[model samples]
Target: MDSRRAFLKKTLISGTGMALSGSLMPQSLLAASSKKITILHTNDMHSRIEPFPDDGGTFANMGGMARRATLISEIRAKEPNVLLLDAGDIFQGTPYFNFYGGELEFKLMSKMKYDAATLGNHDFDNGMDGLLGQLPNASFNFISSNYDFSDTLLHNQFSAYKIFNKGGIKIGVFGLGIELEGLVAKENYGNTKYLDPIAVSREMVQQLKNKKCDLIICLSHLGYSYQSQKIDDRKLAAQVNGIDLIIGGHTHTFLDHPEEIINKDGHKTLINQVGWSGLKLGKIDFAFGKKNEISYANSEPLAII
Candidate 1:
């Protein structure tokens, strides 16, 4: 147990390719002068309520909701300022969604105390009415900045963005979903207009900045990267400004650590995505200085064993 903790601590402190703009302060001074916030995230859960069976598979006996809950609880017990988030696809994969229709997933996420989550293409598998039916089970906020649900049954059901104040540090989180036209069946996402992600992201950033948020995060369901000119997380990070971190999903990209991309303003935007089926959890720690500026940041992807 001690060795495991040591391994996690080492991984967290020794994150590679982390982008920083300013000089880093001494550890002791930073600890005294800055406040630390730990962000824990997951993506593309796809209704894996229980861990994979031990059938000699790659992810066998891994990624159960119970284990995730225990791990999250342990972390929350140690860290006072912690945010738990998800980048969508919380529905449709296993038989659970077929039987429960996302009710179980939302209830479990609520049980795990998810702060916010976005929508994914697969999330619309059961259709708009299917998703709306399970909304009563979720306790957290569903943020979707780009997906316009004004003309659908889901109108006014989701927030464009949400601001959270954790220990006097203001954190703004918005969400962006993929273009669901061809991806999703037209009837599934009926009347839900897909807005331009880049444009919406810029607007969200400006609004969040105007609100004086210390940290800005985007819960993105737009896959990590793409070969063509698709607006994935990487493109969004490079094109949009003021988004400090983007927790992403889709394409099931397995990342050991967060990837850093320089935005239009030359500032660093970190993009992270864990593979599907709740196999891993992405964790990032940010330290804010007295002026509410991010002094340091690091990340690690925790394997759900």
Candidate 2:
């Protein structure tokens, strides 16, 4: 939680006062002042509904959905404006998914109030038709900017981008998925055309900027990084100009802190990913000041113990 404290110190004192006058301000005054938005995210949660077995293996007895719900509830109870997000791979690991075909996962995420999520390679495991059958169960929006689903069964099931206004601060969020070729079976995705993530991101960011978004976040399932010339979150950060934070999935990398990279425009971009199976929750706090000035203040990666 305290990992990003240093960045907060740069915030003007007037902006810092929002933390003091949290809930007791007039509506108009609150709108005029700085606002805080908490972002909680998860990735590669491959249908581990229950905690791991109590055996002495790695992550033993760790990461259950109930515990994650409780933790999210506690945090939301304290923070007025919070966004819950998922990077992807929300299906196909445990027997729960094998039996239910993602109905349970969608029901649980709806109950937990997930704002949005992207697509991962394994999410296609059940195939397009299988995924369509479970769409009615999810209350949250599925966002994918690059994958052209017009020829598939999932057409119009997902939004390319969404804008959320939290405490008068406009936050723009979009999704980026990894290439499905060689990763997913052709029969599974059918005619879904995969567009270049970098190109799509460039367009989305410009649109968000045009809309005067105070913050821009990319929910990515392109993995953290790779040795070869594969497009990862880090590469996207370097290429994209306006993305402020990238909540990523795949490769199941457990990052203690977000990797900060300077973009082509020399603006800072953050990339954070929690390990698979819901062992931990990644939190990023965005505090907004006058004009479009913003600060990525704190990160509280809480373990679901």
Best by TM-score: 1
Clashing pairs in 1: none
What are the Cα lDDT values of the candidates? 0.87, 0.85
Candidate 2 segments exceeding 4 Å error: 1-33
For model 1, residues 1-305, the per-residue Cα lDDT tens digits are: 55434433343344314543333556566456548988999999999977898999989999887778779989899788999999999998889899879887887788778999999999899899999988888889999999888899999999999999998899999999999988999999988888999999999999999999999999999898889999999999999988999999988998877888986589889888889999998888888887989888867688889
Residue 39 shift from truth in candidate 2, angstroms = 0.3
Off by over 4 Å in 1: 1-33
Model 2 TM-score relative to the real fold: 0.88
Tens-digit lDDT track of model 2 for 206-293: 9999999999999999999999899999999998898989999998998877878886578888889999999999988777766657
lDDT of 1 at 214: 93
| lDDT measured at residue 108 in model 1 versus the true structure, 0 to 100 | 76
TM-score of each: 0.91, 0.88
In model 2, where is the ten-residue run with the lowest total lDDT? 12-21
